[model samples]
Target: MLILTWVFVVTAGLALAYAAASAIGAWRWSVAARNLVAELTAGRVAPAASRHHAAELAGLPAPVQRYFRAALTDGQPIVTAVSLTQSGLFNMSAVADQWKPFTATQAFATARPGFVWDANITLFPGVPVRVVDAFVAGEGLLRPTILGLYGLGTLQGTGEIARGELLRHFAESVWFPTALLPSQGVVWQAVDDTSANATMTDGPISVTMLFRFGVDDLITSVSVEGRATTVGTATVLMPWECRMSNYQTRDGMRVPLTGEALYITPQGEKPYFKGTIDTIVYEFAP
Candidate 1:
């Protein structure tokens, strides 16, 4: 009786396993179709979805359909204003009580070869002042403006911080050479742009990204929690928080300028960085 029962259990398990595989396969295939469609859109095969498909997709949820529409649009790199709150450990500014936090604004003008990320900042009190800077993302790069009134000057030769370096030193003390490339894919979930739950792993080291945002996806906050797993040791973890929000769009793209980032070191010391821009109003030349 025992032997017969074992045989039956094994047989049933195989059947269930087969069924599960079939289900997952079907799901993956569906996802593949969408991915293929996305790639096609990226490659300029079809700038707009066929009318029939667009109508069919309209039957889905609004956000999903919005994403679908965005995907179908021709690979005209989106040009929008990015107003980011600039702050960092290097700042000599203070966070006064009942006073506003560190903030700035930037005009994100994007095109093919590169995008010009221009920044403006007002770091003085009682004095209405602004600074401007432009950086090209694809081809033509802009130079960071010099804040004449304030002694704090732009990082001497860093007009265009390479995307590779930006993604690497994102929250790290310094840039890491072996950081994963952008093509790896970025998956982000948020309780708002101010607070987010994210995970990006390259190899042995896994980085946890957390953030806080202003009401309208103005990233008024950011946090990158790090975890280190060693061969024979327990894991090491850390936490920090920053906030930013407020924006001005030059084109149709929305950019968040009022933002902050909180950093905690391995030994547990807190630090903050904020984006600094003076004026940010988007105007489309073309």
Candidate 2:
């Protein structure tokens, strides 16, 4: 009985020690996250100038410097921004080659009123979907101006766009297909990367917005990729890649010049959709 009692005592002590250590680790992680975000925002260009110091920042994952050199570009600030509800058209081969309209709405912000937004998604055209009426929860840069004029036609309960998917895609869409984006504002974030994951048709693929910056420290392009399977087909899988590029300036702010999407199925089917935006009518109304 004494031996069993001693074992129980030892086990309880070890468990308590483990619990304490875990609590301490979580606390440290929280504090580190706070400091990291602070550095990302206020650190800005000054932080960029000090590459050695920038490397020390805990805001981004250590691999961030290697994967995203734009974060350390000259004159570029640690920009956080958003793309509000954008309505577009898309066509898919999974659903009897059905073409439908899609409306994507996101609400975001930054610490400052300045931000550069480059976001795009492929949709079915000739379907003309309308932005009925909607609201964004996180009001970063658009809190005072852009939000009001935009999403004026959004609808209620169509659904709220997930902010996490928005940020993950935001990281990808910022560069490559587009010029680049730079700004000092608030944007969205996600714990997981969704674009690279596998998805099925009729599974209601939540829209993803890829973000990265281009040359001139301005937002150049944005892209969203989605996939699905044929509803009643013989186990056929279709993969799609859509990218929006070509940026134009309206009243000093840059907007995408053209948006393009490509859909590919294992059965040799490629449907293409493209859009040309003539002018951007919105501005940062500070």
Candidate 3:
């Protein structure tokens, strides 16, 4: 009976130590994330014209114009920054369907097109993986950690990773529709009645995406060819796509509440990230 009591005490002490470590690690990570977000939003200034108007849509592609008309209202304030919370499933396997549930909070700065996404994925009960995917100062960063302490891997570079992160920023612009407008550096070209090509450039990186629109004038999907993806230890360019749905009005603007990202491999479409937005708060230009 004494031995059993000792074992219980030891186990309880170990569990308490682990919980304390995780709490400290999470606090440190949160501090770092706030610093990164500050860097992303620094030097941003309000646009000369901070409100949307129908006149701004002229000369854009037909589909692009329709999308703006449906997504933004006249005199609507342009979004300068955004923060949102999300919950959903993240696929852990590259070739198989091993999905884990996750919760995330993201912040975006539209003036220079940057974002930081902080997420926690539950590997199993009581075990969580923390990840931060960000694009700031023309550099892309992907950092994943177990319990916010031990990093599993870190990916950052100037070429493919940077380009890929920028592409992600541009593709996800639908949530902040005004960022896709001409005044915001997006160049739209008509692809068809239902599709258009939108290109954006930031410093040394430039990307183009094909946006498909539904009859309601909302974005159906955004696709690009030659996005860099890691296979084993090598990096390769592959076709990638993001689909948006469940449009709802928020802060006088229409935005998608659910989204999914996938890679179009030679075999077929392999979806990896699927998320639903829980709440969104916007900081409009003054």
Give stretches of model 2 more than 4 Å off.
1-72, 82-128, 131-238, 247-256, 269-273, 277-286
Worst 10 residues of 3 by lDDT: 43-52
**Candidate 1, 285: how far from true, in Å?**
15
Tens digit per residue, CA lDDT, model 3, 1-286: 9999999999999999999989988998999899999998894667646888889889988888889989998888889999999999999988999999999999998878889999999998988899999998889999999888989889997788999999999988899998988877788998999999999998878899999999898999999988988888888999999999999999888899999999999989999999999999999887
Best by TM-score: 3
| Predicted candidate 1 versus true structure: per-residue lDDT over 1-286, tens digit per residue | 9999999999999988766664664455345334433332333212111122344443333333343243333222322222233432233222322223333322232111112222333345432222322223211221222232332333212212232223222332111101111222223443432355444532233345553433333334445444221112332434555544454442333343444544455545444345544444432222
> Can you write out model 2's per-residue Cα lDDT over 30-78, one digit (the tens) per residue?
4533443343344223211111233333454322222234333332233
Per-residue error for 46 in candidate 3, Å, reads 2.7
Give the clashing pairs for model 3: none
Off by over 4 Å in 3: none
Residue ranges of candidate 1 with Cα displaced over 4 Å = 1-184, 189-208, 211-220, 227-240, 265-269, 279-286
lDDT per model, in order? 0.34, 0.34, 0.91
- Prediction 3 global C-alpha lDDT: 0.91
lDDT of 1 at 176: 14
Candidate that would win on lDDT: 3
